[model samples]
Target: MKVGYEFSKESCEDPVMKGELLLLSSVMFLLYVVSGCPERCHCHSFSKSVDCSQQGLVEIPSDLPPQTLTLHLQDNEIHQLPAFAFRSVPQLITLNLSNNSLSTLDPGAFHGLQHLKVLNLTQNSLHSLENRLFHSLPQLRELDLSSNNISHLPTSLDKPWENLTVFAVQQNQLQQLDRTLLESMPSVRLLFLKNNLWKCNCHLLGLKLWMEKFIYKGGVTDGITCASPDTWRGKDLLKIPHELYQPCPSPPDQVPSPAPQPGSARGAAPSLPEDRSALAECELKAKPRPANLRYAIATFIVTAVVCGIVGLMMLVATIYGCAYAAVTAQGHGGPLAPTNQPGKTAGKELLDSPAA
Candidate 1:
């Protein structure tokens, strides 16, 4: 009886010891995760967010929590971003890097952020972006690049942003936009493009046509106003008439073949066909001369003057005909015509009747 009582007591005590050990292990794990966060950043385990904004961080922290979903690194003094800067935090969803001094980004700066949705890079000094810079972020939705100094966008994208919804690029130095870039974002809904230096020339005609279709399909824009060519300045791009683009010269039918190099075999194929082909491609992509705008204006003015002259001549002819008809009618209706005819007839009859 005594041995059985001791065994039962030991079994109950064993379960309690196991529970204590498990609790201690969990506490130690939590401490480890907290300690893993960067010294200047605060990590919230429950929300999986990291806050490092306004910390004067000159560079991205190397030690970021693997489970981090949201990262706030705005208002920092970071100047450049290296390749794969966020590879450690692959699950990042929202990244705010606004108000930084970032002027350069490696092509792979956003690598490993497959699930990132929103990125804010406003108020930066970015003058250009590398091709395929955002290729790794396949799920990006909203991208804000307003208030930068970008003069142009990449002519071609390595991967299309099929899921991008909202894109803002206001207050830049962009003179024109490549229509293909907008076409790549098939799912885009809102586009903000105000306060840019838009040149409403032949190069921008394609974009104007695309905007019409986009707006017709329920997309929205703030309207791009021209800032150049004096005549088109202060006018909305969409309002410009299509006739303005008609004066642009048609593209050349083919690139002229380069002259043969001296001392080369006459019948032998060119040694640098690749270089020639590249030259031809560039020529095909070049924008039409800006002088075409002047031609269009001149044509419009001449047409207006001709039409005005024709209308003036018609008015003068109508007035002259009416004045001449009024004078003839007044002379015929006057009493002088009847009196002269009667006097002449009476005089002739008396002269004929007189016998002496």
Candidate 2:
């Protein structure tokens, strides 16, 4: 009986001891993670989020957890970022460095962050970007550079980055942006460019074309107001007539060779269909609409008919009024007083008299 009781007690104690050990292990692991977290930041291993925002950090903090997925380093005083600064973070998805003082980034700043999806650099002091800074980000989807000082973008952006979707560059100092540059982001769905110094000259013809094409394709965007060339200032970029811009130069179908005559040499060169289309486009795009023409013709006919009726009525009234006055005068005169003067009408005698 003593042996059985001892065995039962040991079994019951074993399960309680195991439960206590498990709880102790969990507390120790929590303490270890807390101790390993970087300074001036709060890291949650469970959620894989590191928030180091507004910490006056001049550079990225070291010892970021390897499994970090989201890092919020916004509102820091970081001025420059070296190449592959985030190389240690391969699984990082969203990196928000917005409202920082980042002026420049090394070409390979985002090297090994292959899984990174969104990058926000809004409110930075960036005037331009290294062409390769964003060249190889495979899974990058959205990039926000709004409220920056960027005047131009690198031609490298013209290369297609498949998963790229949203590119917001509003409130910048851009005087002109090439449609070809915007074309690079073929997969982009939204382009927010509201407040920029858009120089609306012949140089803007391509942007104007892009705006038309973008709208036709159901792309959404706010109205862009022209900032210069006083003629187009304050006007919505989309609403301005394409005719306002000078036509783009058409590429010669065949480089003009002196193989033709002197006077007609210009016409002798064979033109491609593209050239013909461009020439047609160059012609005042102010196409005459049949609806407007028909409306004008109908208006003219209606106006002419109304005027003719009015004139005819006036003429008839004038003739009737004159006849009525003459008849009434003749009737009131009681059979036209016999004129003493021969060959003179009594009406004339009465008209000639002072107060007849």
Candidate 3:
């Protein structure tokens, strides 16, 4: 009985010790993961978020945990992003790199972030972007690029961003946006476009047309004010009348004119009358002043003419009224003069009879 009791106690103690060892191992593993975080960064185990912001990092860290889902690297001194910068953290979903001095980015800077959804790059010095810079981020949804010095967007993209929803480019030096670039992001609902040096000419007419449709479809955007073509300065791009765009010269067809055959009569009149007509049409189109200025002048002239006609009509009416009033007074005055004279004479005769 004593041996049995001792053996049972030992059996219970062994399971208890194994349980203690398992818990100890888990704690050590947790500590290892926490210690594995890159220097100057705080890693959150449960949320898989890493914060390295304000660290004065001159470049992106290469030792990011593979499971990191969010990264904050804002307010750093990072100046450029090399290709595959985030390849070690392929699962990153949110990357905040705002307020950095980033002026250059390799075409593949964002190559392996397949799950990244949000990217904040506001207040950078990026002047331009490569067409294929964002090709790897198929799931990107929100891209903030405000307060940069970007002058233009890529005319075309490698692929359409079907999931992109919010895009901001406000306070930039943008002169115009490519209509095809906007069309590529069909799911975009919000656009930030204020404070740009918009050039409201034929180059921007396509964007104006696209904006109309985008607004009608419930998309929201701030005003885009024009900064060039003195006539359109300070005017809203969307408010400019479509008629103002009509004077823009249409792009000439790419069909090359047949080079005159070798030794063909030098300076010979063009054989085809159509060629002469087309050339004349192009010259005429090119020499016209801006359509809006012409439209304004025409409007002003028409208004002035109409106002003059109205003033003349009013003056004529006033003259006719005065003449009619004078004629009416004269016609009635003749009858009133005789009627009052008879009354005055009868009153004098009645007074004389009373005296007699």
Task: Please provide, for model 3 over 160-262, each residue's C-alpha lDDT reduced to its tens digit, 9 standing for 90 to 100.
Answer: 3789999999999998798999998899999999998887777788899999999999999996998887788898888877766754454345335667888
235-297 per-residue lDDT for model 2 (tens digits): 887777765565655545433434565666556664345545443333223333346778889
Which clashing pairs does model 3 show? Answer: none
TM-score of each: 0.65, 0.65, 0.66
Any idea what lDDT model 1 has?
0.85
Question: What global local distance difference test value does model 3 have?
Answer: 0.86
Q: Give the TM-score of candidate 2.
A: 0.65
The top-ranked prediction according to TM-score is 3
Question: Considering only N, C-alpha and C atoms within 3 Å, which residue pairs clash in candidate 2?
Answer: none
Per-residue lDDT tens digits of candidate 1, residues 227-258?
98777889898987776665444334354546
The lDDT-based order of candidates, best leading, equals: 3, 1, 2
The lowest-lDDT stretch of 10 consecutive residues in candidate 1 is 277-286
